[model samples]
Target: MLNKLMHSPSHKSILRLLRNSMASTTPMAHLLHDTARQHWRLLMLYLLFVLLLSFSEACLFATIYQTMRLLLGAPSFTEIAGFGFTQGQRLFLLLFLISALQMVASMSRAIAGILSGRFAASCQRSILPEIHRYILSLSYGCVSSFKIGDLSHQATLAPLTINTEIDERIRLLTEGLLALIYSLVLFVISPWLLLMAGFLGFCIILTQSWLRPRIRLAALAVEQQRRNISGTITADLQVLRLIHTNACQEDSNRRFANEVEVFDQKLKKLSNLRSLLEPIAELLPVLAAVLLGTVSWILSDQQNGLLIPGLATFVLALQRLNIRLAKLALSLNALTENQPRVEILNQLLTPSGKIFRRQGGTPFSGLKEAIVFKNVSFRYSSRQEETLTSISFTIPRHGMVALVGPSGSGKSTLSDLLIGLLSPTFGAILVDGKDLQTLDLSSWQNSLGVVSQDVLLIHDTIAANIAFGSPVVPSPEAIRHAATAANADGFINRLPQGYDTMIGEHGHRLSGGQRQRISLARAMLRNPEVLVLDEATSALDSHSESAVHAALDSFSHGRTVLAIAHRLSSIRHADTILVIDAGKILERGTHDELIAARGAYADLWERQVHGLSRPHLHKQL
Candidate 1:
């Protein structure tokens, strides 16, 4: 009968109503539904246990009612003619039923606890990986918009919030079911009293409805403030050296304190709103009980002896129902509080909210002929002007090319295009007569090595940093060879721990030159087909730079090198040189040829050679 009732149309309608309501109010509802579908069998078994517990509690209450009647000298049960049982036998039967109900309730409670834990674990196992995968799938441009701290919070905290939301929803459902059962039992005993309780429940619902919007607003404010504090801390840590050098510790502290104060104020406001829910939920039920008792007292003259036990059973059922109602209220409050986090997470997971890189099916083995940038034009989304305009260049296989330009003259942007980090807005980049977009990006990128002005080093052993992205783990000899070629081996060997010494975050423990050398070593370990160096030796002193240049002269014998340099002396021996200014290529030829031509490149070289200031050079250009 219970199974049939569950499969009935009314039951399906109730479920649909619940789903629609949750979907309209919070984005977490869809996540919860997906998680439920993944673990439906466990969820069904858990619900079954909850139902059994509710039935056991009702049976226990029935036994209590009979015991109360017998103790009050009231004959509530009809005597069966055939069995003819004595009062003592009846008492023994009630005791046996109560014991059986208690035992069933205890077992069901334990099983429910175990199932809830397993379900939570299952959710974490599935949801966390999905979150991470989505975050990784986002395009570089999209990811750059988010602060590291904010993104970290999304990856780490948002998935946990989903699990918490699931737990709260489960609790809400369990309490709601238990409350419904208790209400039915109460209604069977006294319909008028049940009506009074329903009215009080309606009042509580209205009060919650008024408070919920305010709570949600406060919770959103708290979440924003918290992420702001996280972003501020992350930015400060990344520039800790700058802060120390400038002696801005006091100002930084004052700013951080102000942020914390705002965060605390918002948090307290949210807490106060949530705290208001419990007392109101608890108080309304008590008032309903009082009203019921007053009505019963006024009608005492019309009641019989059986009324005493019936009334006692009804009040007991109402009290249990009130407990469940209070718990349900708290669960609802928790769900509302976490709704903002769920919305943010949903935005991250949803494809419409992000830009994804376009991928192709063809795998890139190796570049054979050349990388041709034909009429390439590029612009950032935030900027109206083009960063690279009508740029045409070719990086031939096993040939050396260099780009020279003023600051913000699209040199790094060109390297970024070559690295496949940005796509051209107008023209095509061809690889071996095929469109660069037609080949697999990961394969293309894996075959190239890049060393930028800002060196990227992880907090690990020196050897680990050098061999960070190698396809296979490098042997100790190979690591030493790469470090030696980059002129990093001497300082590394001088350290007490040699290659095993731990570098602090971003290699903060190392000097600027040392960090740059380590970065070069990382690139050297790859033995790439095409090497891109954007001011790769800017941090190195003259002696180290000369040594690295000699090493590169040997390394560049059979490899393609695209070098972007500001120091004219570094690229004077290149096979081809391009001078760029204001997103346009002003001159392209050999360095000596450009010097002989006495164009922009020669003018810039003259200024650098005589140590002229940039303001004068900009004017001359």
Candidate 2:
């Protein structure tokens, strides 16, 4: 039944109502429906357990009523039929049976609770992985548009919220079923008492219905503020060095304090609302019980003469009924409050057709002749001006191709295009006369190794980081060979645990040069057909750079190498150099040939030589 409600067409109307009340625009019913489908079998079993527990719970109440009748000296129905034991013996037997029934009900409820918890846990397990997979599937551009803190909070919190919602709702359902059974038994005794309970329950339901939208709105506000707080803290932490250097600690503290204060204020408002509702919920149950008890006493004294045992049973059942109604209201309120969270979670977890990275194309075997870019142009969606314009280049197999240009001259954009991270807005990138788009990007990436300006290292051992790309840990000899090729083996050998040593987060324990060398080793481990170095050696000091250059010389002969360099001296020995200026290739030639041409490349060379010689000139002074 719950599963049916989750997917029923009526839920869409409820969502529309919620949207109108809370002003949430994201559609979420589909996401929740998908989640339910994933665990429907477990859910059905959980409901089955609860149903059995509810019946046992009702039987326990019945036993209690009969035991009270025997204690109160009332005649049992069996005695009226002339077949009953004496009251003393009857009470003793009732006590034993009540104890046995109570124990059975308790154990059954416990088992039901366990199943309910497992079902909730299974929902979380399912949602978490699906969210992760969807995030991975999103386009690079789409993923980058959201703050990391916001994304991380939603991903982690959403599934947890769903789990809680499921558990609380299931518990409410079972309890309500038990209450219904008790109420029915009361109705059989005295319709008057049941009628009063019906009125009180109706009042509770009306109260919850009126407050449901408010709770949802408050919850939505709370979540939005939480995301804001997370984003603020994350941004502040990332620039802690800048804050301390500028002596802006007090300002940062003030900002963080303000954010937290706002968050707290929202929390207090939500708390106040719940506090107000809880008292009303508690008081209604008491008033209903008092009214029922008074009516029962009056009825007992009348000529119709309600029996003492029946009155006692009605009063007990009414009290239980009151508790259930109170619980039902609270549970319903809780479900309403979490509705906004579910919507947000659904938005985050749901796979959007337009936002996903493209998939399904023929596998790129390997570079056959050359990678050809024909009049390619690209502009980021966020920008009006083109980042690359009518750019043309060819990188042949087994040679070095260097792109040199002024900063922001589209060198990096071209590299991003070449690596299939960004598709061109116009024109095509071809491999061996075939369009790059026709080949599988994943396979293309697999064959290409990249060492960038900002290298990422996981918090792991040297060997693990070096062989991170592989599904299995590579042989130690293979790891060592890669490390030797990147000139990282020397440093690894000197560390306390060598290859077994834990590198701190982002390789924080290693020096910049050491980190770069380790990154190079990781790329070399792939033994890629094409190697891309985007300022890979820029972080290294002169001696380390020379060592890396020597390693490159030994390794570059068999693979196509693409280098984006700021230090002009590094690419002087390139097989071909393309000097890009303002999204256009102004010059292309062998390094010596370009220098003779005295074009953009020659001008850049002069400036770099003068820059390199400045220290010597200063020493002379």
Candidate 3:
């Protein structure tokens, strides 16, 4: 009989349904599925415990039916099952079986709970690092498109949501199995009661289906509002100084309050919708009981003694089924609400959904001769006009090349291309006559140092920040040497903690010139073969600029340098200067030679020199 049931079409169908229900095509679902397959032993053990729990429940229900029969004096044990036992013996055996079933049920439940918690912890441990690594691997443009708050939500919260979804899915499966077992037992006791119970269950499912879309919509609204609120707060905090200087505190407060109010409204609506499922679920068993009693009365023609025991057992099974059904409904609702978060995580983790930087196989050691750009052009993906157009330049080994251009004239874009942060949309960049795209980017970047106007400093000691990204941690001596070369040693030594002083977030505690010098120190510590400076001294005062220029004069001896600057004085001694305007290089020569030509470079030099001569006049205008 057991074999026949196992091989039955209905049984096969049930197995297929459960399998299909668990399988999903979403990226997060795929990750969890792969994780589960890797830990199949634990998963199988968990299922075994669940099955044991169901068996204990079944045994408990059977014992209840027997106890009911004994209380009503329906039949002796010998008459019912041909057992040669006295009434007292039969009663003792039934009570002992009940106790044993409860013990088994408790043990199985506890074991299953422990296994599930461990599995969740393991999944989280494996998933977080993978997400972080993938985020780091994404192309610069792709990552920049996300707001800080939105990206934070994706990285920290989305994985947690998916993990919870996995747990809820398991619970849904368990409840489904338990519900099926109870239904089967109800069918055996009384088919008429089982049919009524099935009808009531169908009603509950229909009600949940009606509520599902509304709850999901409300959940989406709440999630969107949450992202908005987080983004607003982060943006506000980051620019707190600006707000204070402008005296916009009242406006900022009002804006934040409005956002919070909207979030509260949406969150309240979502809560109200989710709360509907529980109360509806709780009301189901009462309806089932009423219907079961009515059906029993209608079938009163049957033997009262047999009917009473059967009716009692049928009600017990139906009540258990309803509880499982309600739990299943709640799990489904929770999964529905988290569906949007799952989709966001899917987009983030899925390769096809994100832009990943291309990696090459060939390793690069160091520049041999020159870095050349051959008719390179670049347009942002969202723009119609190219940012850099057909630009070409070369920085020979140990040579100093400078780029001077107005704002939005492609100077920084060119530097980004040289640094490998961005790839040219057309043409090619060659390092030692080899295509830049064909060389390993990591190897190429490791040999280059970059310092831009906007310095990035973490909240760490001076030495730690200087040595942050070096392939090898530098010794204290090396760090000091780099700082001295950047002209930052004096200021750092003046600090009470010296190299061990903790900078505040983004190094906000430091002056602009101090921050720039630390950034330069970080770049110099790499001992790079090439140094690319993007207006590195633009924020420095005259004294600091002179000090940095003095350091650069000494430091540029054996290194190839690419300098992009608006202050022409800094690049007056560069070996070659390229004047760029409207995505094109209008002039290329030494600064002195360009001045002699009296062209665009000469005109810019004249304007800057004139502006400095009459600073008050320029400020007034």
Poorly placed runs, candidate 2 (over 4 Å): 1-45, 80-83, 240-248, 299-307, 611-621
TM-score of each: 0.91, 0.89, 0.91
Model 2 scores a TM of: 0.89
When superposed on Cα atoms, how far off is each prediction in RMSD? 4.8, 5.3, 5.6
lDDT of each: 0.82, 0.77, 0.83
The alpha-carbon lDDT assigned to residue 105 of candidate 1 equals 89
Candidate 1's residue-wise lDDT over 257-292, tens digit each? 999999999999999998899899888787778788
Q: Sort all candidates by TM-score, best to worst.
A: 3, 1, 2
Residue 429 in model 3: shift from native, Å? 1.0
lDDT of 3 by residue, 524-572 (tens): 8998889999998988889889988888777777999999998889889
Candidate 3, TM-score vs. the true structure?
A: 0.91
lDDT of 2 at 570: 80
